[model samples]
Target: MLLDHGERILTASEAIFRGTGTKLSGKVAGIHWHYGTRSHAPELTAGYYNTRFRDGYLPIASMFARHGVIFNFTCIEMKDWEQPGDAQCSPEKLIKQVILATRKAGVPLAGENALPRFDQDAHNQIIRNANLRLPEDSGNTTVEPMCAFTYLRMSQHLFHPENWRLFVSFVRKLAQGQATSNSWEQEHRDTDKFVHAGGPMVQEAAALLH
Candidate 1:
């Protein structure tokens, strides 16, 4: 069913472009998939992974690539489970699977946060994922960085004084370059301390400058 939906979208897009006499060469079209991890019992993880990827994403991936559809995925900020017992279906593992699939299909990739978050940790995770810095992808130059990244949603909380400050810093870091894991950790620590020490008034005043 999902595959059929994807095909219909591609077909409709082609038709629209043809009817409007618009060339599709430079046009961008994408399909967004929400990343999901099965954290069930370890015994069931393999089956779930195969069903979700092999049957679900893998088949549609090639189809999308053939139509020049970008694979824009979400939930990039999820962390891996530390417990060995729960490692089979960790977010890291699931995200890696998606990355490999997209790379194999020769599709351009993009990402989005799963939720609206203003913390440095979440932003750093998004940066790492977007840069394809996963341990397995390290030194693998063939893997490309995300073509783009979208923050999940805009909400009242996002505009709060402290949140706004952190958000500005996050944007700056992203623009700078690909950050190493150590740099992300240091930034997380510094941001935590700063947020704790800053008062509401100070944060509001600081936000006004940016």
Candidate 2:
């Protein structure tokens, strides 16, 4: 909705939550922001992290919390306070920025990646080792496992450094293997269907909590 409407999903959510009366957000909740390139183009531009955030700001975070919207931005970064331009954002810096922004906006945040997952023991352990009871309002503070920890770790590996070399290597390999394999038409359709079906895996991953 935020993407289609171009702004204000968060504010509206808060109003809805307040009107409906629900507790804000959740302990295991998380958000992801995609940065860098979406495709190969003469000019590389536009992505979740690079996209302007001032448009919606914290209304989404705040509203989601007020109404118990657990996770958010399934594929966008929470962003941080820095330069107005997207060039300044990095994965680590963005993480810090999100932590600050979410806190200020009154919703604690985390870097969440979907499963077939990664080990989040570091993130969870920090909270657990502290042995915190749930926040009076929050119910649970544990960063419960959404799936195997490897997915999260792998996601970090894929995006944290913005693995340009890996991407380059892939392109080089594809270019070298430029011969298109002739496949039956039905085979192509079947492959497309299987690829599109990964969406269900993602939803199932989100539903998983340990």
Best by TM-score: 1
lDDT of each: 0.62, 0.35
**Residue-by-residue lDDT tens digits, candidate 1, 85-152:** 43343566556766777777888777777667888788888777877765555578767787777786
Q: Which stretches of candidate 1 lie over 4 Å from their true place?
A: 18-49, 52-55, 82-89, 134-142, 180-210
- The Cα error of candidate 1 at residue 104, in Å, is 0.6
Candidate 1 scores a C-alpha RMSD against the true structure in Å of 7.9
| Superposition error at 95 for model 1 (Å) | 1.1
Worst 10-residue lDDT window for candidate 1 reads 25-34
lDDT for each residue of candidate 2 in 1-210, tens digit (9 for 90 to 100): 433332355456567777665644433222222333242121122322223334222554555455455433221212234224544333433343344345446654433433322123323322221122323325544433111111133333333222423322222323333312446574345444544555465445435522
